[model samples]
Target: MFMDLDALSDIIVLKHVGHGLTVVTAGVDRIELAHPLTEICDLEYSGMVTYAAGGSSVEISCKVARARDEGEPSRPEDLLLTCIFTMVALDPVTRKPVAIPRLVCETPDEEYLFQAGAARSLERRTERKTSLLEVAPDDEESALIHRIWLQQLKYRDRSHPLRQPPNVLAMSRTQLATAAIMQPQYRNRHQTMIFGGYHLKQTFELAFCCAASFAHARPTFVSADPCAFRSPVPVGSVLYLTATVVYTDPAVVEDDEAQDKINKDGGDSESPALTRVHVRVDSKVREMEHGTARVTGQFHYTFTVPKDVRVLPNTYEEYMKYMDARRRVRAGAKSHRSLPVAGRDGPNLTE
Candidate 1:
């Protein structure tokens, strides 16, 4: 669905979402429900379909991207939406849930979200602050998204589920990408201003490419740091984007006994170990009139990778970037280690 980011931002500013609660709609389509027998998400949702099951939910997190470049990426000066979706299964008879027999979700993805949610609350309550370029993985936005997902998941049943391993960190690999985009085609659509999503989209694409190429694997889109669009790119401005992989390392640390046990079971030793890649992106818009450049926006991204992958930093710049990424990751981890909010802002809303 087409989401209005400007509208969402206004809501966030107003906190019209019932006391700091934000529910942004994403352009996410439901693929299909997990089959009751095999629990496979193999079907795509086409219109005019019938659900033989009970009520279910697909939770998605969406943010507005600027759509000024109507050439390749069409837009009517609109908010381009990016999304992360989660699906839960429901039963047809009792209108309950069909519990999928799986291990406990110790996946770094889930753990990070749950723990980071608390960590963020602690940071906000403590001394930590944030910027567009650097964000703790477990920030308020992450917490909000994760909380929605966790709430949706609670509808299902879990009994004696085993635990899955967290993602690994990719510290040895370093990646970089730079690109320049032409000005908007639909000048009338924007009238006299540039859309923020256009620049944001360029930076995000570069970051994604850098991460995906560096890993030599598909990088799942996780979370991105906030982009305020504080500065604007002028009309006829050529936006230049620089994307790089700053930090990476394993996320999980198991005890010696647990490690040995997993090793014996052919876990990380056999299966590729997962890692987290932190990608930072910055954009500078070239002003046509003054021939000067101004920083328009910056963003940070988190993606999963295999632990065996090493992103080595050869240059001093790369090394510093790596250190910076590590610092952010550590900060995020710290937030996850704090006392989580029972619900939004600390009070238990359910009561």
Candidate 2:
């Protein structure tokens, strides 16, 4: 059985810097982190620990690692900050506390880099070397796709109805990335992006499962921007959620003529072939009084798949057939939109 958005939303909380809180684990058990810190390493050096209420224990750890400069200080340097949090939820009812599932959060640390003057010295050196390379112009199309995907990951759940009274919580982007990878099709990718609260992760996982089941194709996990918290999810609220593939397209291929043109332009083999996908997520509070039902936020995501995996003639052709069938179904729905209302009050319309 699938969990409703309301039932799942009750146990999860979203915090700033992509941290999530789960209020209940193993059904009817309250869990929380006692100490929250900005940097994971602080937890270790500072001797901090996370605790759970109602006779349960949770352990979390964090660390920061710097990425080496790709070329010179003048070019962009990607730094990785890894946060690892492990939770062992003990069943309050059982008193045995067999290890509940473990949760881990990892991210390429963005917080400290954003701090003023932290990277100023490196930034100055990068400016010089950046001008010397056959400086490739920015690819706006790729950038746009990335931006949209990140925004969808970060801001889609600002108005979650389950978040009534906010609470202190810690969440990590790694968890979201893990959930995305859990989708059948996306398992092969080495990288992924995760955002939002624990409930949000559950919603994404649910949608991913549905999409995988419906399409019978595994998705390719990619990147997520960042999640920002707008409100807090309270404990013991029933959460409901729905996810769907809003748009998908077969991978594109380049003919010999196109390849020749690229060769003439001196482009490298690293040129990217693009495939796109969009996912929509809707969340709400369930198990509430009548008239209190509400929709949280919706997210639209676009994924870019490389041409090698997506554009092979066989793969492209196969995906095209699937897309065609999907389009027909959508068209059939559109045809129904203009029909006359059947009920006395007329079919309720959403505009």
lDDT of each: 0.43, 0.30
Candidate 1 lDDT by residue in tens digits, 231-346: 55656667777777776554112134533443344334666667677788876777666777877655777777664443444444554565556655666566432112121122
lDDT of 1: 0.43
RMSD of each: 19.2, 23.4
- Tell me how far candidate 2 lies from the true structure as C-alpha RMSD in angstroms: 23.4
Output the number of the TM-score-best candidate: 1
Q: Which ten residues in a row have the lowest lDDT in candidate 2?
A: 165-174
For this target, which candidate reaches the highest lDDT against the unseen true structure?
Answer: 1
Candidate 2 off by > 4 Å: 1-112, 115-196, 225-231, 249-274, 299-351
